[model samples]
Target: MNTNQKTIICFCEDITKEEILKAIEQGYTTANEIKRHLRAGMGECQGRGCMPQIMKLISQKTGKPREEILPPTDRAPIKPVPLGVMGKISKGNQKGV
Candidate 1:
């Protein structure tokens, strides 16, 4: 998927703007909990792309400051690297060479 067209909100995994609002209505106050319950940011990218948009939506809906919303967990593999790169690194390295 092209980066520009990609959305910070994931709609395909049954995550909708309304659903996020509903989760807020249900008192789920953290993005982590929302990720667990709604699977909105649980896809392959692991929510790196969608969390910001979700936060914006939350801030708008609840009248809460954006800073009050917890930031998303920043895991490794920042960019989606090809497995071929991993394979090359592994094969080219030798123990105690």
Candidate 2:
């Protein structure tokens, strides 16, 4: 690894500072926007680990307050699950469905 390389921001998604900077340069100013553009917060941890860092970066780069950079919209299945479990649920074998 290069000595000057930025550390990994999102371990689950393998996002780095350079990638986030590039996305910001491309006009993704908000946390949600950057997530969508770079898949930074869509990983298994669901941004639990890197959201604060991302928010800070966005705030610093865009001159916005940390509170102003909203977090990404959380969807159903907040926790990570095996793909096969989702397949079973989709197939209607889920207990309630």
Candidate 3:
């Protein structure tokens, strides 16, 4: 494959290989760091589709084993919720919107 080709890693986030490389060049070498810098793994898939590619890129750029580059931490509220649900909760707690 052409090294300069724009490979899409995070389809949901529209992240590309060049973007990932730029993140690495900017010292975002770990997957989590790249995630913070580029929002590569914060899309609808939530790293499921892009993490492997991100890890591979980090490993290749940093000369670290893939396993050594830790995955981004998965936090609570793993799935998104409707705004209406949040609005209802807020209304119940306070007098005003």
Q: Write the per-residue lDDT of candidate 2 for residues 2-77, one digit (tens) a residue.
A: 7696789999999999899889989988889989888998988899888889999999998988889888898778
Candidate 3: worst-modelled 10 consecutive residues by lDDT: 88-97
| Model 3 clashing residue pairs (backbone) | none
Regions more than 4 Å wrong, model 3 = 1-4, 83-97
Please tell me which predicted candidate would have the highest lDDT against the true structure.
Answer: 2
> TM-score ranking from best to worst?
2, 3, 1
Candidate 3: C-alpha lDDT = 0.86
Each candidate's root-mean-square deviation in Å?
6.8, 3.2, 4.6
**What tens-digit string does per-residue lDDT give for candidate 1 at 1-97?**
6544433367447576667878988987678778877888777777766788888877887888999998667665666668998677668866633
- Give the C-alpha miss distance for residue 26 in model 2, angstroms: 1.3
lDDT of 1: 0.75
Worst 10 residues of 1 by lDDT: 3-12
Clashes of each: 1, 0, 0
lDDT of each: 0.75, 0.89, 0.86
* lDDT tens readout by residue for model 3, 9-56: 999889998999888988998888899888898988788889988999
Evaluated at residue 22, the lDDT of candidate 1 is 85
